[model samples]
Target: MNDDLKQAAGISFIEQTTLDRATIRTAYRPDYGAAPAYKSYPDAAVLELPRAAWQLSEARIINLLQRRRSLRTFAETPVSLHQLAFVLWASQGVTALAGNHLLRTAPSAGALYPIETYVSLQRVEGQASGIYHFDTRAFQLRLVVEGDQGSGLAAAFLGQQFLGQASFCLVWTAVSRRSMGKYGDRGVRYLLLDAGHICQNALLAAEAVNLGSCPAAAFYDRELNDLLGIDGYEEIALYGAAFGAKQETTTPLAGR
Candidate 1:
């Protein structure tokens, strides 16, 4: 185990990337002119979502927060298109456009949304199981790979079969250059933070819709990136979550 955690492992790499006053004083240089163009797939077939068709329950924020739990098991029932749309909206739906940037449901550093949203569906209402990309610009779903992908993704996650049991799983990938071009090394740090903000919104949204929710992070990076059809360097998987009808096995808040 000690040999496996050699000095040149991930911790060392992350430490090297940490931005500090001294490091910035000597090594910081940013080119503000660079901005990432919007991402899309023109060739993929699109499905416009029925946004706001399903209302988030009247549950208050405090209750939702209190009830939020990482549900590990889910029912076999399919997730509705409306529920999926709301979850996406809660995570990355564009609320407005400012100049060239699109402001979303979650806050982003410098309005640079380097994160992209994708879905792996095992079962969904009015949609076939497949890999789909959420195009925030048009509020549409682009079919990336047709047919079920949960099993393959489950394999990449080292046999975390529970992921394959959900109605669908949302995967977030980061385009680091989008943030780094403006803030230099600091922007790289923002990429991970942005992902956290987005996924948290998703988890809360799941609670609002009465769906089971669980965040997923353990996965083989290269294999997952390959499944998403993105090069491991330019775009990489950062976070994910499984959501479906509640087959929950959780206790109430402890000693409130």
Candidate 2:
């Protein structure tokens, strides 16, 4: 983990690039230390989903809502590329118009939209396992991590085995500046609330597409932020939702 990479990843902790080399080396042990960036954030790129990706119907949406539940267990079924695209689109993609700005599924305080989405791909059919930034405006995923990033996700999320088995995991991060620039301390509160709204929408969107999902808040903060190349203070992990097919024997929930 070098200082140059930290800056590109939008990390805010390092004081100077030279100091980071020694700091990162000493911090390396079992769990602490900066994680290498998965990939560079590409300029805004628009993705064109096949025409068939738009074939989902309204009846399917309602059925999913009625059957909504947190699915902890997953089948070994691999999610299709189109299905992934659909949920991503439904969750935070721009759905309508509001003058010059765009509208999305979940509402935000003043529509500041402080929440950013990242995906750790594992079992999607057409995509490789890696980190990616969800470009809501372009309705596409911009690749960030270029290789299998699921293993690191499981570790960061407190050894959540289900996270690794799932086809994809969505990491919700907050860009504090977007809100804090206006609301100050209150911005912190709204930033978290906004993340919740986005996660719920993602869960519903997953159900609508016949995929299972579970929202998680338990994880190592700095570890996850580094894996996603996010600066802990400015943009950090808020929550994660694991999605995939559910296997019957995978124990949906353990007794508390």
Best candidate, lDDT-wise?
1
The Cα RMSD of model 1 versus the native structure comes to 16.0
TM-score of 1: 0.74
lDDT by residue (tens digit), candidate 1, 168-245: 999999876687667866776788899999999999999889998999887766678889998655566878999999
Name model 1 segments beyond 4 Å from true: 1-59, 248-256
**Per-residue lDDT of 1-256 in model 2, one digit per residue for the tens?**
2333334323332222212222544753455768787965578686867644544575676677778888888888889998888878877988789987688888999888999999888999977788899999988788898988878888887778888878999999988778766786567778779989888888988887789999998777767888998776667678899999766655567685
Per-residue lDDT of 10 in model 1: 37
| lDDT scores in order | 0.82, 0.79
Q: What's model 2's TM-score?
A: 0.72
Off by over 4 Å in 2: 1-62, 248-256
